[model samples]
Target: MRAIWKGAVSFGLVSVPVKLYSATENKDISFRQVHAKDGGRIKYQRVCSLDGEEVAYADIAKGYETEDGEMVILDDSDMADLPATSSREISVEKFVPSEQIDPMLFEKSYYLEPEKVGAKPYALLRKALEESDRMALVTVSLRNRMSLAVLRVREDVIVMQTMMWPDEIRNPDFGAVDVEDAKPAEVKMANMLVETLAGDFDPDEFEDDYREAVEALVKAKIEGGEIKAAPTPAKTGGEVVDLLAALQRSVDAAKTARGESSAEEPVQTSSPSKGTPRKTAKKTATGASAAPRATKKASVKKAPAKTAKKTAKKAS
Candidate 1:
């Protein structure tokens, strides 16, 4: 994969020059939106809201609207003044236990590769991180935004996981709900169920059944094959007559399904190829296409054509 950013991991006097590449990639089946009637790709244009005219992409700027209904436009000059934003250096702030950092803060992960003549120091830092069992907190500026990140050892290389800022994380106040607490007997049954189904997480053992199913559907459409509706879950009495009985049945069914297939969760997502956003073409004022055109042709030099007929036609 191509490296998106090139920078160094700076800690004290040590500087490990490295290239950053995305560690993971999305593999979900996807689709492109098109005109339902003609199958043509849908296009959109940037338009000025006030004038009702198409606008060019270059004319657009980042704007923040105020509560007083005023737009504040910001350009490159304004961004350049931000703290450590344009800095390419991933400056290591400090070292802390990896567990101390909440996983929710982590956003994107990148694989760090050592550049030429920087391999030795890169390996040194990787080894040090592995031995210490701690992750290095750092700051990286990407795409005109400054972000906090953590550098950790993964395999023989160092991986940087960019984190969300504290302000970006939403509070759990929206989830304030009070429900009946679990009973001791139900909790005991839950523990037994967990133990019965618990196993080591082998990522390879799992398959993306949803993606496979979607791909199969796409293939069927292309090949003009028969497609049956997905099997719906067996309906049961809506009322839960016995909570323990329901839990026991679910556990037994899960065990049987586990023995049958490796497919787990059926979560699906769209992953269409990136398409270029439509930009408005400069609108021209005149349109000759709407006006009629004269059909100009050279007739067999109509023998100066019978002056009488030409004169008659001209008169008519």
Candidate 2:
């Protein structure tokens, strides 16, 4: 892969020359809007909102709008006058625990590879960071914009992950939420349910079921076959009247489904009889005087054991 950025990892007074390449990729299929009538490709043109006239590339200029519709246009030279640090350095500011960073702030990640002469130092730094379990906060300028990024060891390689600013995240405020007076029992039950369903996060087990279904439908259409829709699962019955009873029932069901009960313990049933075959109870050993039946028929042949007494009797 081609290097997207060429820079140096700067820490204290030391700088390690490195090259950055994207570490992840997206493989999603994309479609473009088209004109169906004439089968002509649709194209977009930039137009001035005030005049409603199409604007050429050369006619466009960056402008800042002030109060009362005042505008200040900035030319290329004016933009160049703005203070910008060199793009050749990834200036490290501080070191922090990787877990301290929120996942939402992460924007993109890139693998950092050292140049030929900097290989030894790169490997040493990556190993040291891996042992220390800390990430470096760094600033990198790319495409005329500066971004806050984290530098850390990804296995044997160094990785740089760009982060978004805090202001970009939307504030959480549940509008019109009716929580004036929630019942204590309801809250307790909800908490219990959540606790019961809690588990370690594993990204591999989750999938986009809707997207897969849509892709399957598209494939079927392309092959000139009918797409069969999956039947919707039956909706669960209404909420139970007793909260504790429901929770206990749910716990019991989950345990039974997972076969957590002992082999000797009989499973309790709450189902109504609907002509289903019932399992016959096994008879206790002492319940009846009947002897255990032999598995083989009485006429089956058996091998005779050799005995000293039998041999003596034969001699006599």
Candidate 3:
């Protein structure tokens, strides 16, 4: 597992240099938009709504649509002036009881591996958090943005999980979901039902039935000699020749379209081999009190033709 970000964890006068690796991934199978009659991928162009003409990638600039319906176009210089931090220190703000943290705030999880010289201090910090039964609230800069995260010990390893700002969590307005309480007999029966089903959670016991079924169906189709060969997507005028260059252009174009290059949440880094996230450590620490919800995972935005085709479809 290659390190995506290199930084140091600092608390009081102690500093532990560590490498950060994403601790989670998405396994959802993806499909693409295509011509059903033929094996060709559908493509899209960046056309202006008003002019109705395709726009060049170089001509694109970030635009912010105000609440009053005004478009505030911003150039590269404008975006450059926006406040961004790239600090390499994971500064600990305070140690708080683990239970105090709301699981809803967790956005992403990462593992921290100590540098050779900082091994002792890293273990000390992990042991301290475990002994105190607390989590170290920290501020770290990742991808040129400062974020709130927590450092806690999970199975003798220190894990850093980024958090969302309070305002980002919308308050539910269900208009008082209050209802009458159940009768004593009904409540007793409900408790009995709960006791009947109660058991320790072993993650291995559960499986992604939907994903497994899809895989099996695809395998059966392949065995039956059913397949379509998607033609290579044709490149437009002045397209980048190199794959890496094209990918970088797609990333930059996506950032420009969003009007916000700053990632609110940390995203996974590509692995050295198959592009999937990898772990070199013996095991991962995912049994922390504030386990990140699968729904909140974030991915780095990319906009290649194939990816854009997939993006146009409703997510699985």
Candidate 4:
């Protein structure tokens, strides 16, 4: 893949030339809006609110709305005059353990590949990070916006992940949970249920069932098949009157579904039945068994053979 950005990794006086490339992809089906009668594509135009006419791209300008609906327009030169502290260089500030960073702070990830003769330094940095068990905290700017980022070893290569600002997160302010004063027995049962359902994380075991069903429905529609919506399964009624009994029933159901019981499940094998003719096995006088040979049947002649026989008798 082509690199999206080319820049140097700067820390102290050291600078390593590197290139950044996207690491992920989206695989979603897309549709377009069209005129239903004519099947023509629809188009949109940008019009000014005051004049009610289509506006040209050159006539547009960036503006900020302030108090009292006042507008403050910013020209290209005005934006260019902003601080250039985070313009070109990735300035490393400090190093911290990778686990110390919260997953919510990450915004986007890009693969960093060393350019030209920078391989030694890149490998050195990767090895150093692997040894230190830490990630380098750095800042970089793109599209006139500076963002905090983390640089760390992803296997043998380095990756840079942009982070969001702290203030971007909203505080959780639920007034109060109505069921805060839950009964002791309910809490105990809930804990027991949680313990029973707890399992190791396995991403492969999970599936997008809704997406699969939707795709299947699309395929059926494309094939001109009659579509009938399936009814949603009704949930089991009523709360558990006996928590221990419900838990035991769930555990028993799971075990049965997994076929984990020790009673020796029936082995399934395919073999020719007694009704089907089989090759005869040979047994020698010395009790040594010999491999069986396959038998072949003779083909019967039809009306042509009878005609040939009549012609032969007439000739005789």
Candidate 5:
């Protein structure tokens, strides 16, 4: 894999020169906007409201909008003059227990490979983190913004996981969910369901079914066959009022589906996080299986610079 960014992992006075490569990838069968009738690619123009003319790519500078709708245009030179904490260094602030970092704060992960001269220091930091079981909290500037990231050893190599700012995480205070009642029996049965379904998180076991189906559909269409609708999961019976019964049935069903014994043994109930919103599945014409895929697609967006993207563009 090609390196996305070239930088140094600041270890005190020592700088470990490293190349950063994306540690994760989203495999989605994406389609660009195109004209339906002519099958031509749709393009967007950067039109300026001040003048009725299209802005050239290089001429397009960023503009910060004020509350009263005034645009403050910032050119490359102006942005360059702004202070950067560390433009080309992953400056380690401190090391903290790995578990202390919230998984929700994690945004993107990158694999750090040592440059020829920095290999020894790189290995030293990696060994230290492994021995202490701690992750180094570091600040790195990219795309004109500084992001909080953690450096941890994955196998022998150091991996950096960027995080969202604390303020970025929303206060999930939905009043409706706060008032939802839970019975002891329902809670007990739900925990049992969790226990039965809780196995190793082997990502390889799950397939990108939607992407595979899209590929199959394309192939079938090319071969002069009818495009088959995506496989819809079998619809279950409607929701029952008895919460305990529903949980028990769900546990049994999941066990049966996994080819395990449908036995209802004593189980410890884990109370859901206080005030956390529960996702209630709704029956639809298509299936709920598409929801996860749609979420991934929704995350796809474009951006600007300070001036670079840490992630690579989708390879054609």
Candidate 6:
């Protein structure tokens, strides 16, 4: 990769010259706006609001608008005197414990490659950081702005990651929600469900399904092949009054998908007698049980009388 910046890291009396290269890249597909009828790509021009005329790129200068609608235009000469604008050093302020820095504050990352003359000092710094388990807080200037960044070791290389200011992070302001605490039974079942699905996270096991589908669709269109519309998926969402039952169902489904027996899920069976309470029963190893059939027959025998009474009430 090509280096984006060349600078020296100054920590005490040691100065290590290094080149910075971006550590990550975007892989998203891009598309351009076009005319629907003629397939011509759309283009835009920069027109000034005050003059109603197109402006050239070189004529554009940075401007700041005041609260009362006054524009303060800044030229190259005005920006040349800004602080840190001409600085070529990544000045290390202090070494801090790595855990003290929040991961959310990190913005961009770059790989630091030391020059031939400074390689020994660079290795020394990396070794010190690794042994002390600390990160070096540093100040850097990029694109005419001073930024706070941290230097840490990744594998055998030292990486510099720019950070966002504390004020840039917004505080969460969600109002109170009226939700009841989960019951012990529900929490137990939820724990079971979690255990059934828990495993080490391997990024290779997941994929960008939407991107793959889009590529397949485009390939089919290019090859003049037939395309079929996918069926709409059934929705499974509503007010959940029985959280424990829902959690158990989820655990059973997950276990089944993992090729495990679902017999461990508790089966509820009610007595045949009227006003008798229901009780939990477990299925045998073969998943065969007589309690569920008895409950079904009992419910069937009482359904006709209940239906007749409902019909009579409606008639009245």
Model 4, position 273: C-alpha lDDT score:
54
For candidate 6, what's the RMSD? 26.7
Which portions of model 2 show Cα errors greater than 4 Å?
Answer: 66-71, 173-188, 225-316
The true-versus-predicted C-alpha distance at residue 117 of model 4, in Å, is: 1.7
What is the overall TM-score of model 4 with all chains considered together?
0.61
Which residues of candidate 4, in runs, are more than 4 Å off?
84-87, 176-187, 209-316
Span of 10 residues, lowest total lDDT, candidate 4? 291-300
Cα deviation of 299, candidate 2, in Å: 99
Query: For model 5, how many clashes?
Result: 0
TM-score of each: 0.65, 0.60, 0.73, 0.61, 0.63, 0.62
lDDT of 1 by residue, 1-316 (tens): 9999988888999988889999999998778654343243433445556643345677888898999999999997896786656677999999999899999999999999999889999988998899999999998889867889999987787999999888898888877575458788998999999999999999999999999999878788968854332222223442332232233334434554456542222112323334622111100111111010010011112224353244334433
TM-score, cand. 1 vs. native: 0.65
lDDT of 5 at 291: 34
Error of 4 at 217 (Å): 4.9
Per-residue C-alpha lDDT of model 5 across residues 42-124, encoded as one tens digit per residue = 43445555443445688878899999998899998898898765498899999999899989999999999999999899989
Pairs of colliding residues, candidate 6: none
lDDT for model 5 comes to 0.68
Candidate order, lDDT descending: 6, 3, 5, 1, 2, 4
Give the winner by TM-score: 1 or 4. Answer: 1
User: By TM-score, is 2 or 6 better?
Assistant: 6
Tens-place lDDT per residue, model 2, 1-316, is: 9998787888887778999899999856566443343222344445566544446789899999999899999999998999776678899899889789898999999999999978977887788789888998898997778889998887789989999998998877777678858899999998999999999999999987877887887897968854332222223332321232223334444454556752332333444256632321111211110111110111011212232223223433
Per TM-score, the best of the predicted structures is 3
Q: What is the lDDT of candidate 3?
A: 0.71
Clash-forming residue pairs, model 3: none
In angstroms, how far off is 154's CA in candidate 5?
Answer: 1.7
